[model samples]
Target: MIDALHTHRPRIVVIGGGTGLPVILKNLKNRHVDIAAIVTVADDGGSSGILRNYINVVPPGDIRNVMVALSDLPQLELDLFQYRFKSSDQFFAGHAIGNLIIAALSEKRGGIFDAVQILSKMMKVDGHIYPAANEPLELNAEFSDGTQMSGESEITAAGKLIKRVWVETNDDSHKPEAVQQVVDAIMNADQIVLGPGSLFTSILPNLMIENVGDALKRTTADIVYICNIMTQKGETENFTEADHVRVLNQHLGMNFINTVLVNMKEVPPAYIDHKKWNEVSQPVKHDFAGLRAMGCRVISADFLELKDRGAFHNGQEVADELLNLIGRSPDEE
Candidate 1:
């Protein structure tokens, strides 16, 4: 970890995947903290899963979204990169331009890490972007009924009650190890943010990596979890705020989460469109007493954003709370 005496800006390492991760990154972009995103590689659906199957590269969907969020590129160029082919187009149908580019670069560079580093420069990304591991990872889960599932999309689509979740290598010869830079970022960070993403698939899959989890446990940095706005059907159905924290602690085998930023705003009745957001079930219930019992410093606020007929985190509000935890002001920049 960087010493307190150093005159550098506060270093923050945010860990997770899904659309939620990008929301946090974009909101913190102009802030004073140095940012490093350790994205999950266990995604196995949509264009990412298709590309992974064809080329054996890490899923680039989350990384691609994160890159656009942090990239300082012109809007037109970014749009070109993000453009997805229509279903009418053969061969290229259902593929995003960025995913294909990342796949090609990964093959040439011999690893996703180096490809992302080179891509980060080309995309003019402001902060660091690190894949959780060097290669593609498969998410494995044990359900409550003693049934097991593999792959992120399958698990979520199965609609099973999750008992546990972890990550494993695709092949027998490989091992799950995050690169040194990821560990260094975790160790040297002032705060490590967990997630506002999927509990089983997005966040825990990354933590399941041996070295990344170890670095988090060993780091001097304060650990914070940006609690989800709503509970999801497959992963966290009817879970209280404390249940989320408990699951994370259980996965790590310790009470490592130091702080939790929770949204206390009540969702207006009939606001959520369940058909539009099929995965999301209901607003996440709070249990402040339960959170306090876990030795967690809880900070609850009106960090809710209701839009497009769905409930979501107000990233800037959550970012402000995160900065406050580290004694940094968001406006200092």
Candidate 2:
């Protein structure tokens, strides 16, 4: 079995958004593994949403980030891809150079996926980046109090308890190509990783796609979840570690995940304050006792670290832990 597994490196499918997914991709790029990043396309804010609305393209912010993370380019080229324009003009201000490039390509090709393919070829990205859906989708959140909110930004800003989330679309504008690619990747993958990002906005939004969720349920891959280090104020205000798993199961169905990765290292109070993070609602401490009851194995490790202005998992450490959990000999495979 080990020899057969070694015949081909494991294929990995990582689903999420924002900085979190990119960080993971950056580390995994160096490994001899096949990777596919299925990014959330529900963003309707900032430059990405602006381009999406004006040009009718999929949000490129997350896609750009993933591309940069997986790019095999020189440091200078990587920096160039990440550069943003600083202008007083509200429209162009804060727009990333990569976003603009993607927007222009979308105009040239007349489709966002086409633009992404072009950019991927140019950057020589180590993995594939795909949008969760082709249609410009509005995220709808139904609160426990019977309140409905539209837009990911508004839902996160509402500070209300979300009972459930669904994509708002009249026609079946889902991208069949992206869906088929994800299904094929999942069917052949050895493992699938689901986020350490915002539960509602970044992670769950991708899984809410009907076909995406269906593929996940049918895939033979072992699913693993990386729990977030800190909770978002309006999103998961007082959620616990177990709460994350429970919520994920609610959408993807029960027994969907096989392993849960949690940060076991103690975070320094100084680092926490420097990052302006309020641990008032600290990470759901890995509910080892409770997780065992749910038939999920809990993998504890010191994967947590402080980076930029927030708490993050040390990419190297995270990769090492995950590789170990999957029984891959880091030195050999």
Candidate 3:
């Protein structure tokens, strides 16, 4: 089915981190699309955190996910990259094989971007991947009372309602190569997508990068945001659809987004219960009226695909909806 869609070779730039962006990219792989993933580097937990502390390297988990998503490699190679060493020792526990590969490449190239390029080529990836920043960035969050928490994991666990988030970087040097590649991809892209991940941590972190934000603001591509399926407890608890768009505007500024793709269907009660998700805590109901008030078009559909305890987007469904919204004929070259 996807093989036939690869004819037009549309250029797409998907921005975010964590597991979400890669899921979307996986669905888009080998289709008639040129994918360029711009990933957030603010993670400070587990293997990524350890690597960052010891070696001053960008968190490689997100980059690794992007690589695997776009890889046309054999299943064995993919599994090997995702392998994690299980050990009773705290120091050796939970480090992923892919993270080690990226760390090694960073050492070899003396830079993260070059190492990513080399890995991309080696994997026969269908698209490119860029870290939002070249240098390691520490995420800091200011609370309503002016107290600040440092580090991404700490910020998430701080328990104080976040007032604002920013990157800590004294070095003013920007990675021109990464920035240029992002801008080039954006300028040439048919579509640019954001989210389906943690709004502030995953999506906004990419936008927080100076050059990356500038490229997004200047891009002529049609923008679409895949709204999260559920409100994150610590981060976006009780946030409505309108609230999501509003926060994005607040952080990245107005009109940076054009359309929002929201899930508009029910999840099985059994699945929700099994996943232990509070029914009352589901994604803020799609507020079509409020979304329209924000001057953004809403593309609401039954995008839910229930697996285990969570509701996920059906990849083909999401891809088709995005293509339709952008006016691409399914049969068009």
lDDT values of the candidates? 0.92, 0.79, 0.79
Candidate 3, residues 110-138: lDDT per residue as tens digits?
87888999999998888889887766776
Q: Better model by lDDT, 1 or 3?
A: 1
Give me the runs in candidate 2 sitting further than 4 Å from their true place.
89-91, 170-178, 274-281
Better of 2 and 3 by lDDT: 2
* Model with the higher TM-score, candidate 2 or 3: 2
Candidate 1, residues 36-130, lDDT tens digits: the string is 99999999999999999999999999999999999999999999999999999999999999999999999999999999999999999999999
RMSD of each: 1.6, 2.3, 3.6
TM-score on alpha carbons, each prediction: 0.97, 0.92, 0.90
Colliding pairs, model 3: 6-32
Q: Best candidate per TM-score, number?
A: 1
In terms of lDDT, model 3 sits at 0.79
The best candidate in terms of lDDT: 1
lDDT of prediction 1: 0.92
Assess candidate 2 and give its TM-score to the true structure.
0.92
